[model samples]
Target chain A: MTESWLRLAPGFFALGALAAWELAVRGFGVPVYILPGPIAIVAAFLTDPGGLGGSLLATLTVTLTALVTSAVLGAALAMAMAASRLARAAILPWAVVLQVTPIVAIAPLVIIWVGDPFASLVVCATIVAFFPVFANTATGLAAGAPEYFDLFRLYGASHRDTLLLLRVPVALPYFLAGLRISGGLALVGAVVAEFVTGSGGFASGLAYRILESGYRLEVARMFAALVLLSLAGIVINLALGAFGAAVLRARDGP
Target chain B: MLDIVSVERRFARGVVALEDVTLRLEEGNFLALLGPSGCGKSTLLRLIAGLDRPDGGRLTWDRGRAPAAGEIGFVFQDATLLPWASAADNVFLPLRLRHVSRAEAMPAVHDALARVGLAGFESARPRELSGGMRMRVSIARALVTRPLLLLMDEPFAALDEFTRHGLQADLVALWREIGCTIVFVTHSIYEAAFVAQRVVLMTPRPGRIFREIVSTLTPGPDLRLDPGYATLVTSISKTMAAVLAPA
Candidate 1:
């Protein structure tokens, strides 16, 4: 019962915060144009369900594609880097540079150069998501005990067999951890790129809706879009977290 | 048969681990390399196992023939069982690496596990077993390959006394049954005397064999607590002490 109460505490706190927010806005007679209450935002969400739904679908497509590309390419790069010391030394610096450079600063330039806002946003998101997976996986590949390596050598295991049978399995947990962190970063990168690029018909997303509502002074609609974006980020984080935990549990066994 | 004449090993950092180490082993004989820490006993075993090359001198097998791949099985200090594999899979690893199918190797795997008294634990993962049981799995894996020579580097040093004693007996029984050449390494004089037919004691740092004592104790399950066992242990310990003493 105590454990159950502990689990519900966070939900109760969030409910209390929402109630306080609604009461504060109503009691102060705050202007709805500036900041809409939860009820008004919910009404706006209901009224323009189709438009909001379309934008969400667009954003999700871009984010998921970017995330998948980042994971696959990052894992490949990590494997390549682990296989060759020279490759690691040469490519690691550029990966760091891409990771540290703000997506906001490069989104407009990417859009201008690529001539396609959708592709540019995906590239930006992928850039944001690639580093953690690469770095974490590299570290994990190098993390196995020395005795294990000696055993592999004693068995006359080929380099490919060692990598596939031992190194990759050991590195999976680290890669998943990196993916969990990267999932949220990928979403943020896509939205930030969309905001900067100013989505048109072919590249419209939730960020474009947010920018549209702001310009038209529709506070409730802006809140609705913001809520949707936040929810997307939460879902991505939760999904990746569950995936990582599941892999660990399965490997650990019953 | 294996022969070593004046073998010497020097690390890149100029620390000599082994110097002028000469030894010869007959086929089907059990030998133990006994020494203090940092005495290069492991380096010596590695040299024989072809894991390391001597900086000076020669090592040769009888008839100038090298053993085939997987002919020498090694058990390290730790069990070193692959954490992800079941005990049966781990035992079958050597055969599998040699491209033997699981079906072809299953009987040998079962016999090896049975020899190590782990018959019912074929499907148990390494993590599910205790430390001693894991070591048994490692032994089973080594023995399953049916190697001509078994090299063990203090395989039981980490286990408690009861488990270590039990494994020592199991190992002797297995050796007798298989009639394979065995070279065991250990820092424990008592363990060396208890398990090996001949114990080779070495001096500290830049290790060279200081004494070779052959035991007359018959190979049996209950030879450890025999009255002669204590005398053998004392003789080996005294030799070890003399070797480790000041020059």
Candidate 2:
């Protein structure tokens, strides 16, 4: 069907590019180490998926753990900021500082301080993911319609009730928007942290696999590891997007 | 009975919103505070509802004790329904805030929605409803608590004439049925004359009562076409024009 073909257009382009790359490498007599073709990368993936699979899973676990931690901690901080002006004033500047500081710059110090490579990577990733959620949720909490505040106050609603009923619901859309941004950032942070830690030959996440393959002149295996990392990032973003859409539908009802 | 004794309100920016306003509201009386824009009509209502404090005068309810915010039902100019909530959930808000379970509040919620003629639309969100329907939901939320004093600020000013008329009739019927004191605020002369037993006309800057018009005809569909209602409307309109005209 045309509709189905149109939907698969991106896939066709990807396949076409791979075919062209394979032809170019073979046609040009390029060496396998410097410029491996798509076929060689696929062969590498098929040959040792067991080892590659373990590394992919490890990277994915750290990425997901960091994302969840960021969301929970960020939402709590946002709520606290909404509840008290003093807290907002005291905490907001530090959050901004964390956001502006490059994760790569801090990764070395974090690795040294934490000692455990996994914890260090998670802390680095969480630092990267926290800002978007915190800023968006804080803005959303304060963005409640003025009429709603008056209505709640007229009803003698307690502060707890106002926060729970009015502020939280108002903050949902903004928080979800932030979550989508945080999802991709979390993955990027994980890979960057892993790359920094892998330089010391410590762990077995996908970044380390890529590093090891590069060092051993296994260009095909490195590309395969890179492919897995890209796939993980795409999956994280899509899953977060789907979850946000579901929550919005639920809020609006049928 | 509610008494407002020389109420004075001044905003922080040195703008006088209300000045030495004094009025008394009897139990079960349907009164309309009719005025032009920026005339402190809403300011006075806020004072009565205890949403804002008057700088000078005192407001005393029955037995010289002011009613708590929970005891007064206030409706804003806009519908102000939580867009995220269903009509039933919106109506259940006050009761829920008082720690009433949803199951326990269901009957009262249903009753309030029914009173506003929104019986079957309980599951609909505010965005799903028409403007009139949304306003009805707002009224339902205000009425769910069954407060003895109802304060409405231009509640139907945004609706079409047909919907406004329909709501006005329904409001009169509900008022008669519930016997709650309603202090309705509006700029519409017809609306004031149509629904209220007494219309308190107000002047513009630092608003104070300019004139009081009492309708002798009872509120009903026939009252709209009645010669008496026309005369009352004309008199109130003339008074408003005179008061609002720049000297």
Candidate 3:
């Protein structure tokens, strides 16, 4: 009983906090436009579940595509940098430039250049997500113990073998860490890009729904959309964390 | 079966690590390079192992040319293991690099671990083993390929006395069983005297071979109490102090 209670502590606290929030909103006679209660938000959510769900799915699809693309590109770039000093010197500056440059500023140019709205949004989100993977993986690749290198050299291991077997396995945890960070950032970037690229022709994202609800003074609907996005971010983080821990446990010791 | 003819290794900024060091590696013998820190004992071993090149002289092999790095085994001061891999996989590394699959390399891997007294700890990780056990795993990895030449660089320096003693005895037995040439490097006089048939004392800094002693005392459990063993240890202690003492 105590174990289950401990496990559900966060949920109980959330419910308590929501009850308090709902009471305060009702007691103060606050307008729905100003601060919607939990009940009002749920009612708003039920009124248009299909439309809101579609928008959430669209945003999720864009975020996931960007995340996967960033993972592959980031890993490839990091490996190249680890392999050659020349490549590291040349590519690292550009990657940093891309990472530091605000995606908001670049989104307009990306949308205009790419022509397709979904592809442009993906490009913007990928730009925001790939940096951590590159930086962490690069550090990990260079962080091999010097003694291990000597051991490899003593065995006359080919450079390819050293990189693939020794260096890549060493970098796995670091890459996973980067991927975890990228997961949240990918969602943020997708939402931000959708907010910027609000054309009506393409299927709308949750960000567009939030924008539309805000203009129409449907604050309850906007809050409902936010709940879905927050839940998505939480799921992504928990899933990645569990996966990384499992892999490390299996490879390393208990 | 190997000859290092006046080999000299100089690092950057005119630091002569080894100068005019010549040694012949007698096959199937346990040899120790006994010296103080920075005495280039390790440098000499590296030159012999072809991990480093001699600046002054060349090394010639009995097989007409130097053996390939893959054909020799080396052990470091610490058990340099892949923490992510199991003990068996760690032993399987050199063979893995040679493209031997785990299934194909299983017999050799199992034999190597068993020879080191680690029979059922094949799936155990490095962190799961004790320091001495980790070193045993290291030795197992080195011998898995059954290389003719094994170069060890202060492999047991970090172990406790009891653990060190146990490993020292096992190493001698392993050396005899395998019948391979070993150049064991250590700063411990007792260790050098205990494990090796031949001990070469080296000077500090610009390392040079100061003296060499050949002992016929057979190493076993009672070898530590042998008067001849105490005499050998005492004989080297004076030089060891000289190398370590202030000039």
Candidate 4:
């Protein structure tokens, strides 16, 4: 019973905060154009569900696509680097360089060069999220216990078998940790890129809606879009955290 | 059968570990390499196990043929159980590595654990078991493969006297039942006397066999605390003291 109550505490706290914010804004008679109340944001959200929903869908699709691409490509690169000392020496510095270079600076350049807004945003997000997975996996692979290798040698295990059975299993927790970190990074990268490049033809994401509301001086709607983006990021982080925890628990067993 | 013909091993940086070691063991015999610290007794066991090669001389088998792969099982001073695996899973490691499925090796694994008096502790993790139990799990793992030769390097040296004695008696029974060759390395005079059919006493560093004492007991549980056990222990202790005396 106590554990269940503890789990629900965060939801209750969020509700209280929202109630307080709405009361304070209404009591102060704050204008909708300045600091909108929670009720006004909700009203704006419900007023045009189709427009908000479309933008939310667009942002979700771009972020998830970039996240999946980064995970697969980054993990493969990490494996290749771990497999070859020469490749690690050559490629790891470039991966670091990509990580440190801000996506905001690169987004406009990518948009101009790639000639496609959506593709540019995805490339930017992939760049942002790739390094954590690569670095963590490399460390995990290299950190396999010495005794396990000795056991492999004693049993005459092949190189492939050693990697598959021992090294990969050992590296899994670290890789999942990296994936959790990258989940939020991918969302941030997508929104930041969209903000810099301006969402293009056929679709606009939450960032573009936020930008459009700001230009039109619809501050309540802008606040609503911002809230949606923040919620999406929080949800992604919490969901991935739960996923990584589940994986670790399963490996540990009952 | 295994033969060590003048095997001499020297490490890098001028450390001589073994010098001119020659010994021969018949099939299914129990031999203990007995010595104090830094005597390379463990090194000799490693050579026989083929974990390390001799620097100077060759080790050979009787039929002039190499032993089959997985023909030797080794138990280190540490239990060396994989921390992530359950006790039964750890025991099944050797079979799993050989491409034997868990279902096929399950009965043999159970029997080996039973032989070590760990019949129903299969699901327990190593961390959950006591010291004696963990060592039994290691012994069971070593025996599960049914290797032609068992190489144990001070396997029970870390255990308390009561646990060690219990294991020594259990080991004698297991060896008699399994009928496999064993080369055990230990620094304890009492342990060597208690367990081995023949104890090969060694000199200090750059170890060579100083004496070989053959026991009179038949391979059974009655070997311990026999009347002759004291005399044999005294003679081996004297031999070790003389070997340890200043050059």
Top candidate (TM-score) = 1
Docking class for candidate 4: acceptable
Model 3 TM-score, 2 decimals: 0.93
**Deviation (Å) of A97 in candidate 2:** 1.5
Tell me how each candidate scores on DockQ against the true complex: 0.48, 0.63, 0.65, 0.40
> Deviation in angstroms for A85 in model 2?
2.5
After superposition on all C-alphas, the RMSD of every candidate to the true structure, in Å, is 2.1, 2.4, 2.4, 4.2
Q: What is the C-alpha local distance difference test score of each model? A: 0.88, 0.90, 0.91, 0.86
**TM-score of every model versus the real structure:** 0.94, 0.92, 0.93, 0.80
Instruction: Show where candidate 2 strays beyond 4 Å.
Output: A1-5, A26-34
Candidate 2, residues B1-247, lDDT tens digits: the string is: 8888888899978888888888999999999999989999998998888778989988877766877656789888899888888999999998988889999999999999999999899899899999999989988888888898999999999999999999999999989899999999999999999999999988867778877888888888667989999899989888877766764
Give the candidates in order of lDDT, highest first.
Answer: 3, 2, 1, 4
> Model 3 over residues B1-247: C-alpha lDDT tens digits?
8888888889999899999988888888889999889899988888887777888987888889887755789999999999888999999999998889989999999999999999999999998899999999999999999998999999999999999999999999899888899999999999999999999999877899988989889878678989999999988897667656877
- Kindly give the stretch of ten consecutive residues in candidate 2 chain A with the minimal lDDT sum: A196-205
Model 3: docking quality category: medium
DockQ, model 2, C-alpha based: 0.63
How well is each residue in B32-94 modelled by candidate 1, as lDDT tens digits? 999888889999998887888899989889968877668889999999887878899999988
What does the lDDT read for residue A124 in candidate 4?
82
Cα deviation of B97 in candidate 1 (Å)? Answer: 1.3
